[model samples]
Target chain A: MSDVTALHPGDTGLSVATGRTEALTGIAAGLAWLLAAVAAAAFDDLGDWLETQNYAIGVGVFGLSFIVLGLTGRWFPRGAAWVTRAGPWLIALGLVLTLWQLAAAKLGWLPQPFFPPPQGILEVYTFEYEELASHFLASFRLLAVGFVIGTIAGFLVGVSIGWSHKAGYWVHPVLRFIGPLPATSLLPIVFFAFPSSWSASIFLIALAAGFPVAVLTWSGVANVNTAYYDVARTLGVKPLGLIFKVAIPAALPNVFIGLFMALGAAFSALMVAELVGVKAGIGFYIQWSQGWASYANVYAALILLALLCSGSITLLFRIRDRLLSWQKGLVKW
Target chain B: MVAVELRPEQPAASAGASLDIENVSHAFDLDGSVLRVLDSVSLNVEPGEFVALLGPSGCGKSTLLRLIAGLEPPRAGQLRENGQPITGPHPSRVVVFQDPTLFPWRTVWNNVALGPEAQGSLKQQRERVDATIDLVGLSQFAKAYPHQLSGGMAQRVALARALVNDPEILILDEPLGKLDSLTRLTMQSEIVSLWRSKGFTSILVTHDVEEALFLATRVVIFSERPARIKADFRVDLPYPRHRGDPRLAELRRESLALLGLAASW
Candidate 1:
């Protein structure tokens, strides 16, 4: 982001190391997965140990996960690239726990009231990956649809209100009253408002996400310079060309600020939608794992969601940089 | 096609009829009281002549320039060019304010281009911008932003923007007053050279008698507030007058003495 970043050397060595570590971690994960498959298949004894869930064994496995994570953390790349750096910690912890369960089960760390170690959670996550994907698809589809519609509507509404004094006066008061009234609070009312099963989820998600987009767009439009208007008038750039060429470009930087806020709002609304009861998605997977006491599966689901959110935001920032190149060194995304 | 330097012109006789300002007066009513600023001021600037209105602070000298520029209509005077009445700002007449009021966002080149472009999107106007940039000797600073430029450069950009349209008459209201002494001196020489070189009809407003005496064909001195033309002195100094010349200094003392600054000459 040339406009946003002072961009001091940006550490070429760090970037190189980050790339190298990511490749190493990807290879490591691949080897770990192969080892898991072969180790799980070669010994029926280890498989039985995994299926047993003694509380002491579970705690031992969970504790081992953290120790392995704390130790191998810096071996990964980017220092804070989260994607490359976080994966190894997650994989190592998951690995050590897999080993920890088998080791603990054989050592008689469990007595009663609890099943054996990591076998059950692994069985659910590994064997049920297909089942989880289907559920994730349902929530993700609705989130995509809602986010798209909300963003577009918000941009149009915001620009209109910001550009027109009459629109600002007439529309802003009503939106201010409504937008702040938690979108989730309207879920119960929306459940029966539309015909679809996830209508409430879709409506709430769109409402929550669209408000920030509109607010950002309107403020951007409102703040465009009077000098541009005067210049445009003298140049004979009447009505149509004036708004597109002058007003829109001037306001783009502001609109990006709103969209950045809306990204997180969209994700949170998706979470709320899932919590309110959707058949599939990362949220539903989380809820399902909680219900059945599958905590390892829960951790895996949370990691995947974090990865997607981080990736989406990084991508959005890149797009913003490309679009507003004229405004370099103004904002750092 | 590539215009980079102003083409020097031989001094030609002035092109338009002289301006006639008869019985001009101005007043500002502040709160309840009426403050008379200029009273029965009258003067004429002959065609192609360089006239400098010189006076002390609060003598309403700049206000008179603004009135001539048609930025403000005079209360009691009939201001006319060639014999016709003056009205609103026309492309034929331009004013350069003391502060260089060029738009900051645009580059020096675009700022210069604005005058001609504002007229129309005609292809030939591009030629005018190039020619004016050359005229102001700012050919190299065309792409520079105002924030990147020094005060003198910014003022040159402002002048280039004004001159690009090749206005028939220029009313400069203390255009070099904001500059430091060194830059002010440099600007004065540049203004004098450009005026003589282009042979354009010009009216300069200033409080500096030396600047007035050095630059104008006719120096119109004004009395302090409730201002009137106290004296109209013609300076016979040729183009490129020698600085600090005894004769020029004597004229300076004469103009200042009329303003009651120094002992009467």
Candidate 2:
């Protein structure tokens, strides 16, 4: 038993003694951030910029918090464990921030307008937050509507094809022909055909998300265990029961896979649609900023989009984990 | 007032239903070629009889059970249950297959509750499901998932799932085929007791000779693919028969000989 525990560290509550290195990393990260703040305060920017006081204060506060966390690790063991896990990432981020500040802001080595200092991006957020937020909300509304409709329609289509030979025969050929075409390629035609740009964007997003969902859900339903159907059949279950009770539940793991793919594709389609078809979104904000040649706004909007993508995907996985808890460890994310 | 007529009680009909498999021949089309499995097999089982069909692996015994369960119709034959032509799957004819085949998503209670739920009778028969789960000695595990179960435990849950329906004809397709030896021994006795108590007509297909001798009232042996009936005989032993009984040993030896493994015995 001891040998087994030795082989699998942390299995028997014998987690490796850690946090010392993490504390060291935390202190180093704090020093790096403080140095970056000093550079921001001490140097003059090569590009047109706002006063560096707020940015320097923000960096200094972040540095102080890290230093406190590093010094007071004994009080919160859980927090310490988290810090231990994130030590390398924290260190890397701090060093990168310091280097970026020195390279772009202090020294005039990098090109102006293209590679603005960290403060330039931060200033965009500080001043133009309201506009960015409105754009985010618009994107959110469009994405939510399109994604829900696409998921439902795709799931229904998949089920119909998977469960019925007639449906499969009729729809499978069409799906094969059109499913692989990127929704963005039809942008000009779609925008011209629809009554409104918003509707066209919605349609494009749905098209992008729906194809993978339908194909994957079809395969999921088609590949159910025959024994499950037999069991249900012997229990006097009807055809509908076989599809809903037996097939759907059995195919859920695969359905989740389809949903993940759909979400990723939906995001791509959303950005493209917003870029060309729609007037207001994060993608639109980036395009608008690019037109004005304000690289700082573009950078800010891109970071926001990144955060949104990460957050939405994380939420999707959480829901999947809860619903398919029985299938934990069976399929890797 | 309308006149109401009363009929006399017929206990036999309620106890178990008789099964008749007449001239059953089955084949599967594999790559445009017909692979014949069962050839002109006929067997009539009396109500409440425990009949065991023993044959070589892949000799179409399971296919025969499937036909009896009305999962699939025989290529050329008629199956009648209680003198009515079998059409399709019915709740009264439940099967405990070799693998547990329990839905991983459902708990033990829900898995056993499948029959009543599918039949749209779960609301009233909820207690019956619990009682059935308790019968299989898994009351504590009623809420446990299939993946959480050991092989024997999962098999017991499968048995409970079949029993919860109160099937008149319990078709067991090698139900105990995959259990460990010790669990298999325990389950063999459990099956016998359940049959005696419930008085359900049982048709078990297994490869174990000793298991057949121990649990079944009559043992039917069949030949290889395109299977033909080799022998049919009654065990004639009373319930709770000893494993070391001289008569059982004699019967086992005879059964092995019929299967053409006499030299080993």
| DockQ of each candidate relative to the true complex | 0.12, 0.74
Model 1 ranges off by over 4 Å: A1-329, B1-47, B53-90, B95-105, B171-174, B205-208, B220-233, B258-260, B263-265
Error of 2 at A22 (Å): 5.5
TM-score of chain B of each: 0.92, 0.94
- Write one digit per residue (lDDT tens) for candidate 1, span A1-333: 554345745576576666666556555554454344334444445324344434334444444443443335466323324435566765675476557544534444554213434555555566778877776677668778888888888888898898788888988998899987778787777777878647778777888888998998888878887645543433334556557756776778878887888888889888887887566788888887778776667766776788767877888889987786545375655
Query: What CAPRI grade goes to candidate 2?
Result: medium
List where candidate 2 sits over 4 angstroms from the true fold.
Answer: A1-23, A330-333, B1-14
TM-score of each: 0.61, 0.93
Q: State candidate 1's DockQ.
A: 0.12
Candidate 2 residue-wise lDDT, A156-235, digit = tens: 88988998999999999998988899989999899889999999999988888889889989999999999999998998
**lDDT of all the models against the reference?**
0.71, 0.88
lDDT of 2 at A205: 83
